[model samples]
Target: MPLFVAQYPIGINSHVEAIILQLEIGSDDVCMLGMYGPGGVGKTTIAKAIYNKILDHFEGSSFLENVRDKSGTFDGIIQLQEILLRETLGMNGQLKVCSESKGAIAKENILRHKKILLILDDVDKLYQIERLIGGFDWLASGSRIIITTRNKHFLQTLRICHSTYEVKELDDHEALELFSMHAFHKNKPEEDYSNLTDQVICYAKGLPLALSIIGSNLHGRSEIEWKSALDKYKMIPDKDIQKVLQVSYQGLDETEQDIFLDLACFFKGIYKDYVVDILNSCNLYPVIGIKNLIDKCLINVDQFNKLWMHDLLQQMGREIVQQESPKIPGLRSRLWCYKDAFEVLTENKGSDNIRGITIISPKLAKLQLKAKCFEKMGNLKFLLVGNVDTCGDLEYLPNGLRVLDWSRFPSSSLPSNFRPHNLLVLDKPQSPVILDKIFEFRRKLEVPQNTKYEDNILMDSHSHRKLSHQIDYSSKIDFSHSLIKPLSTLHAFMMDSIMDYEESYNIIVTGKKIPKWFNHQSIESSISFWIGPKFPTIAVCFVFHLVPLKDSYANNDKYGSIHNDEICWNCHVNIFTNDHTQPLTLQRDFYSMKCDHLWFYSNSHSKFQRFFRNMMQGDRNLVEISCKISWWSSRNKKFAPVIARMGVHAECICHPPNSVIIDDNSDYFENVDDSSDDN
Candidate 1:
């Protein structure tokens, strides 16, 4: 028989002692004992202590560590077979899984032993127990199965004939004793600091983990240092484990410490692969660095690849990061919700102070931007906005703003004054207000009337080479309940401003239903007469689907590639691509049909043409927009010939309103000849 690790058995409290003493002895019904508590609360520790004390009476015993961390579906069966085989049958290496046809393996193994002990520790779910030992009539008359778990409800639902015991924090005396041994290196506190010791114990809150950590941290430290440590407890709001845990955290390496802080301060409920990607991107990997982090007990990787940290540990990490480098208030920070963000922005007009901004959620109410911060940020660039509803209004834009992106916020209507010439890319992803507003605004801008009208503006089936580029990166999505509609309007206004003022534009719109205002006529006319003067070519691409290549977004490599069917109607052309990387098909049309314009329209809820704008150059005088139902894409093909185009710029660049000739009684057909002759 193997010798098990010895544990402290003296001073066992009545709560745990009573439960242990009530175990069924010599009963025909199998005896089961369940211990449950919160994570890191000593459920597993206590179970081992009790099991070792009683194992002498048992013919066999086995302990399973971290059964909750198993990965596959067969973890329960494999665990059960291993425990029964080794403990009951004394099976060593080269064990075989007994097939179901050779059933009763568990019963046979257990029946062979008179008294046995089986400990299943860290049982996360009830299915683990039911699959492992529920139906097995394996135990002899005096045998016992001891189970330990964090979830109390799991034990109750097990339907086992087991006595349940809830483990709690140690009392003050026991906690003091534990703390003194670790901190003072003795069973009692030193005479010089006895008073401070008591206060430390009080802050430790009778938690065994807390006592051990604080004790280990304070060992051999000076009296003044001890007093400072004790006083620091007052600063801790959740006086459970954070203060005590901080002592242990001081010993970790810079890298391990950094990984810890990132887990705590930035990402939670993140999968392992995603964290790996981020860590790798930061060039933080060293030999066995992550595994060493796990071994140090700074981080915990669960069976499902999810990483978790203790609340205290998380707080400690956040503090470390904050202390090292506090985020500047005016620097760009990703925003998640509109109300909270607007509240912050509204309180401080950070528009001037903030160098860059990215808003993820769409709901920005009017008051959020009222802050005086905007006036201070004169060098601001890269504003990414999203999560707005269709009718939301656009707030005022800060001057010197570059890269006005709306892929995050989709809108139906555009504000009139949103003209940013330096703007380079616009992605609506759900609204056509950009194209519509541009068509309407161009007519309102009224091109000089002396330029000659070009006849080759209408698009057929043309191919044009279009450039692609990525835009500003941000993860903040607006989560405000009040800003959904307003945010949409805000996006629409910005996108419209781009179309009205900027030359060189790339717009992405996504939706399943077309907007009521975006008709076939608008698509045709905008592709022709409404193309911008400085940059006339546009490529319209549609993203038919968006499927995540991986299950998580935190990973950069895990991405959903955009699939687009790019069309250049001006030159009556279609782009053919084996990979769809470069949609120069529209560029082909720009040269072939002598058309330098493009317009895109789709049903509501489409994400087409996003990739094209994402790949554009930052220096280009362009606008990237997303709208409710329509978008535009255009790029001059390298192969397209530049024509010396002559045009009498129309007074109104957009479609002109029809008015009757004042003095002539000419019929409609006769009037058409006169108009053709004038052209």
Candidate 2:
């Protein structure tokens, strides 16, 4: 059989071959070699392979496996030292070593003159190495020492093991061969099981332990049996592989265990800073806890600072949670499964044990909820309830709630007595009832009066209900392109063009954000940028949030909320050709807005040719142009600064000169507390 444990360690990993090249077996100095990666990645096999190849050159050698588990304490260290002395000295009985003396007597008596080869396999802590081979001054020159570990930092901390190499997972080709060796007893998969083998490879994600265990289990089974087993493994992983991968997790401390399980269960692929904020709010000292987890090779941080772990590790953590309350999910600490969350909220089966919950069903089903659906859960910390279609208002939310992201929230306002002093994030991106205002602000342009708009509102924690005008993303507005909401990408600004403009795509290079950002800082902000003579197609995209629309009278709430639904405001878009006071107006102001919208005004190449012809009729050379958005009350009264994310795009152009010259002339109007609309 070609099983890895039974057969010679050949063709199992490419990293083994690469590492063998760096061993320098014939070198004249003591070489310290270290190999590190997550558990079950074949570190032991590679060490054995190198040891066997170079053992003939050494006077004596020994390969000690599982040193981390074997040499944990002083008593354990003495036991391991006795074994090391017996094997390397070619002795038949126990050596003279004690827990109090450590390896002091053995180092002098056993290895005073001979050149030796020593391999410490799976060494997690430093004591294992210190006791087994202390200082290594006793062994003769040209001797070699090797250590294999799951923790890279464990080896990195030792100056002796400076030549550490990271042993990553297998590539697609290597993974396939490794699986085939165990299943088919050959170099490749059976002809009939090619696609199934590919699926297995994808599931294993190149973890050798998973591949071998799963492949061996499915060997000699019929095609139907293979299909059934694969389906079964989707929900329930194999016990053999889980046992091996969970070893690292089982070694963590209590707080580190909580941090690891939390990341593996809920925060995989989430930004590190955001995860830290959420976990720190729960009193989990995540800074040192996360470092411990990394040192153990249980988790990793990607280039973008997102936390991710091996798929098997993540599955293992979820399995641990499932075991916490196998039949009851609400009794568990965290809930991300939609069905579990739906049952807890719908049946009110939640308890104070529930710390965090998220219900993001793939199909987006609306669960009917009572006014006090979350009353029983008193210790709830974070909630991301989605699409609760209810008639009456929500009565109570846990005062301990910290992060609230309720999607499609039906109520016009939060619970009457809900105090969010501990709330860090209260985000309701597209909830229809956050604010009950239909403020549609646009340029001064005439349109039909009968235009339907979604109701949008904004409120603050410090003020009472106040309705304000919002933009309606309907066809009645003077927009040349279709309206799309929730683009979902941060800093996503690009011009989608129709015609080919690659012929003249040269742009001046500058070190700034193109189509510069003027959102979130002011109600109205303007910028000027230099445009070429041949104006490429431009796309104007903006993200505006008038939710809890701020007013002059409301004491700027910490969470920036305002009471009332029907907010009244007008948006003014003016263009300037290097001018200070007057505007080159080509459109009219739009009235009545209703929701937080991401407005993408796309223009065809022909439309761009015609637009520049109209706006810049006289001065058509390469010049700086400015676009401004000003917000005023419907009755021409000045309003608070409108906060929105606006980005300018030129689709066919790859690079453009960026400029951000903000002009904020919003000091003329007084704060308006007169609620009586005199329009």
Candidate 3:
């Protein structure tokens, strides 16, 4: 007999021994054994240990993990069929679906395997077994199918020629041994801590998972620390094993709290670095925090840095976070997608109740802004925009803003002047049209100049032509390649894409963002890049857009020329060029044609305007550059900004670009009488 090295009482000793007994060549018994229990109850472990013990008697053994988690039902059935095919038949052949049904294939394959031990993990639905192993005739006299499950009725409904056994919890002695190894590193608690150990054992209630967690929680602590833990245990409200496990979670630091919640709610079986990346977005220290979790025994982190928590623990953590701060503003929480964000904001519109908002989810159904709701947000600031149709109709923004990030907005139609003047940080200001609007706003708001309008007009004219060319291309091409296309249709296409992507692949990247290629350098260089003719690409042509400037510098060398003279505006980056499309000066009124692209922005005392041109005709690459910010207060915390995405539009937009569009007063309607307005 193989040694039973595992100390945990997995509760399948009898079944495993029965399988071994039946596997004898002289045994005439044809019996199937099914081991079942709730998730995380050690069914898989028991079956494996048993299988290893008796594999020598059978021709082969097979194991399937997450049979129901795969993409297609047909795929799982085929996988099982292939296993039986190669092992029992000693023939390597792919199972082809003729009439292509899973049931037919399963029926044919099960009869071919003889004296084989098959272990199926996480079988939940009854139909899954019926389609795979419903038939009884296929089993050889000693063949066995050992199934593990969270639902017992799932097996009872199948009602095949199989007897089921419920794997129960460990007894006190077995639980104590498991706990002692983890807690005191001995067979029993240390002499001095016997009383506290007894208290811990009573809380564990003979459950293996609970004992294991409690033991690890108490590991290496002094007697005082152990007493402190015991005191905490006595206060647990539910006194359930899960509640006891949650005590470890409560002991985690604030960062650990956020990381744990994010994992439980957002991802499972996720790669380590991917989790790290998500945590890094919130400027979290995942490395140290994860180690703390592993050491506390609340979670497990493998050599691959893949962190996993017992489902019970995960459920507890999620419930605690949600219940404790159901409505606390700025409390650490997550928005699953842009739609969730919109739903929250829309549901709570006109109230200054929400404290902070994060746009963690990328893909969202398109949303059209209701004019009244846009005008009512008096305190909104932090926003994570997605590249989907959700950004359309965004105009007015709260003036008390600190951060503006449009990296999530995939396209370039966002208005300028969206930046609040007191804004401290601006990231990825790549669109030229938006940049120009900021500079224009800054020039008007900060630096009062009467003659600067003409200079702004000159730049606007240049950008106008480039924009027109792209619009012309869009008009000429099929429906897909237009930039100025209506937001509604784009949203519909996106919705269809979501369904298609979901059906075909299990992986979901949160943002509905299309890849962007245009950058500041590419725009300034007048280099054209195309995304697809189906998608309207950024057109690369330089035109003069208003820019916020620190000082007035002219490209013209001549000090007194009337037409090519130095035109001083709040322009930051230069809009002049060696070659003029016309006379390098326009005699006509440029603002007569409304340029939604024209913008103005301000950064403290300095300002600049970017004259964004057209889409790059070919491929343009967004150059990745890293820079760090130092905070003197938080131990001089320094971190680089993630260069999310970049695009080229035109000239300088000031510090905090004015991306807000003025709303027409006709749309504002009040539920109350005008008495409140008068008051």
* Candidate 3 error regions (>4 Å): 1-29, 71-113, 224-679
Provide the overall lDDT of each model, using Cα atoms, as 2-decimal numbers. 0.45, 0.59, 0.43
- Cα lDDT of model 3 by residue, 310-341, tens digit: 55566666566556445542233443234445
Which stretch of 10 consecutive residues in model 1 shows the poorest summed lDDT? Answer: 464-473
Candidate 1 lDDT over residue span 1-679, tens digit each = 5434323322345644676677755465678887865444566667766776677777777777677655134644675555656666666765555652233455465554556777888775776655555453655677788887655555667665778777766778887788888887677898997898888777655667667767777899999898887677544433446554564355457776656655564334444553554454334572345665554445667764556665556656655543432444333332323543454454563534343454555444323343133445555554555554323345445544445555423234444554454444444443334443432223432322222212222111111111111110131122232211122222332322112122333444332111121111111111122222233233333222111112223111111112221111111223221223454322211101111222232111112234344444333322222212122221221111111111111212344223212122223323321221121
Model 1 misses residue 478 by how many Å? 47
- List runs of model 1 lying over 4 Å from the truth: 1-16, 70-84, 90-108, 111-114, 134-136, 227-679
Best by TM-score: 2
Ranking by TM-score: 2, 1, 3
Indicate the TM-score of model 3. Answer: 0.33
Candidate achieving higher lDDT, 1 or 3? 1
* Residue-wise C-alpha lDDT for candidate 2, range 520-553, written one tens digit per residue: 1212234345455565554444434443323444
Q: What is the lDDT of residue 551 in candidate 3?
A: 33
Cα lDDT, model 3, residue 87: 50
